[model samples]
Target: MAKQFERIEPAHREMMGRQAIFFVGSSAGDSRVNISPRSTTHFHVLGDLSVAYLDLTGSGSETAAHAKAGGRATVMFCTFDSAPQILRLYGRPRIDFRGSEAYAAFLAEHYPNGEPVGARQVVTIDLDLVQTSCGFAVPLFEHVGERPVLDRWAEAKGEEGLVAYRREKNTVSIDGLPTGLDEA
Candidate 1:
């Protein structure tokens, strides 16, 4: 059986806290669906109906562009270790681009611990519905560690190199959508 709610309760927070990875969902009207498997830094529950995830510079900026276009997003979490529940958060997302006041504040709050690495934006989801279902079909997998390659590679690139990489690799959705490229 599946359970649904209006917002994230305390129990959902526990499930969120223990997970290593989750899938982010977004799309523009009639465009390709963007489902990203995110795993670098974990998300933090802002309140009963809010959640924030750091968006590191990845291959594509579809999630940011899609969310910015009109704030549509769905983030899904699955218990891959102990329990067997699938959690989906459907909401409108607010994106804080890098160097913005919001991003700076978040960094200050989580800082020294949340140092500014290759972060590009922060997507905060305002929950509209919370859905939980029996994840009987999901295969359980152990979380070994977060691969350091992204950070290492990003560092090696330096500032200019990262910008070039984003311009080359992260500026477009696979379906030829225009990604909001930073002019830096």
Candidate 2:
């Protein structure tokens, strides 16, 4: 059975906390829909109807571009171990670029240890709907651990390299939409 809620419930938050990964979906209407798998290490539930996650440097900036152009996003979490449930959050997203006060506050509050090497921005979502559904058809899998490859790669690139790389590759989406990286 499926259920819908206006806000995230305690059970939903608990489920989200236990998950090792989540998926983000976004689109710019004229562009391709972007779906990216993200680690939950930086995911934060700010309120019953709001959530935010640290956006890291990647090969592309599809999410940021889509969020900028459309302001809509969906984050999905599913249990791969304990229970069979899928939770989806539909919301309007705002991108707070690095160097901004809002991004600094988010980093201080949720990641006081210091920002990760590839940290780029904070993507905050003000959710409009929360949906839960049976995920019995989804197969279970064990989480070995988060891969260190990204961290290692970022460290190898160094800060300057990362900036150049972002300038060269992350400034545009696959469909040629501006990703707002230049402003970040």
Candidate 3:
């Protein structure tokens, strides 16, 4: 059986905290649906109703374009090391383009070092509902580490190089929607 919550309860939040990786799902109407597996130290829960993640520049800006087009995003965290449960948060995210008010506020709170490299905007999700499902069949795995190459590459590139990479690779969704980013 599946359990649902109007907001994130204490136990549910703890379950999410223990997960090392989460999946982000987003799409535009009548366009390709994207489900991406991401592992980064970029997510934080502000309250029972809202969560935010710093958007990093990478190939295919599906989440940004989709949310910009008024699409909802669902973030799922499944326990694959110890417990057997899957927690999903259904919400509509508001994108915070860099230099926007929301982005400034969020960065003020969480990113004192400035946005993460290969940076773009931020995605703040206002939770509508949270659901937890049984993960009896989900395989368990050991927690290893996040990818080191990209951060190292971005670091080596320095600030200007990172921006250049974003313009080259993260400017648009695969569907060609504007990702609210420019090279310079």
Candidate 4:
């Protein structure tokens, strides 16, 4: 049976900390839904009811666009190695662009390890509910390590290059929704 909580408990937060990857699901009204796999050591629990992740530059900006359009998002973290379990955080998200005071403060507070390069925005989720379920069908696999391709690509792009790239590729969603990247 699945369990639901109003806020994330300590055990739930611990499970999130151990995960190497997570999925983000979002959609705009009357538009196609999007579910994308995100990888990075960039996820953080801000409090019992708040969580945030640094979103690196990517080809699609659906999540940010949908969230900006007042759509809810679901973030899922699954255990691939130890016991079989899955955790989901459902909430509304706000995107803070790089160079904003909010973004800088968020980086300083949660990502003390240092923010990742190519980080275009910080997606902060204000939790409405938390759920945990048995991951009976989620196959077990070992986490080797984060792939370096993204970091390498970002470094090669350089700061100005990344800004231009975002303007070119990350300004709109597949379904023609504005991602607010123009303001970034």
Per lDDT, the best of the predicted structures is 2
Cand. 4 Cα-lDDT: 0.89
lDDT of 4 by residue, 78-171 (tens): 9999999999999998899888899999889877887778888999999999999999999989888878898899999999999889999988
Q: Candidate order by lDDT, highest to lowest?
A: 2, 4, 3, 1
lDDT tens digits, residues 95-136, model 2? 898889999999899887999889988999999999999999
At residue 30, what lDDT does model 4 achieve? Answer: 79
Residues 1-184 of candidate 3 have per-residue lDDT tens digits of 7999999999987887787888999887876889988773888898999988887766667888788788889999998888699899999877887778878888889889766776678888899999999988899799887888878877898888877777787778888876666621
Task: Please list the residue runs of candidate 1 whose C-alpha ends up more than 4 Å from where it truly belongs after superposition.
Answer: none
lDDT of 1 by residue, 45-140 (tens): 888999988888888888877865674899999998887999999998877877688888987876657555687778898989999999999998
Tell me how far candidate 4 lies from the true structure as C-alpha RMSD in angstroms: 1.3
Candidate 1 CA-lDDT value: 0.82
What 10-residue stretch in candidate 1 is worst by lDDT? 175-184
lDDT of 2: 0.91
If scored against the real structure, what TM-score would every candidate get? Answer: 0.91, 0.97, 0.92, 0.95
TM-score of 4: 0.95
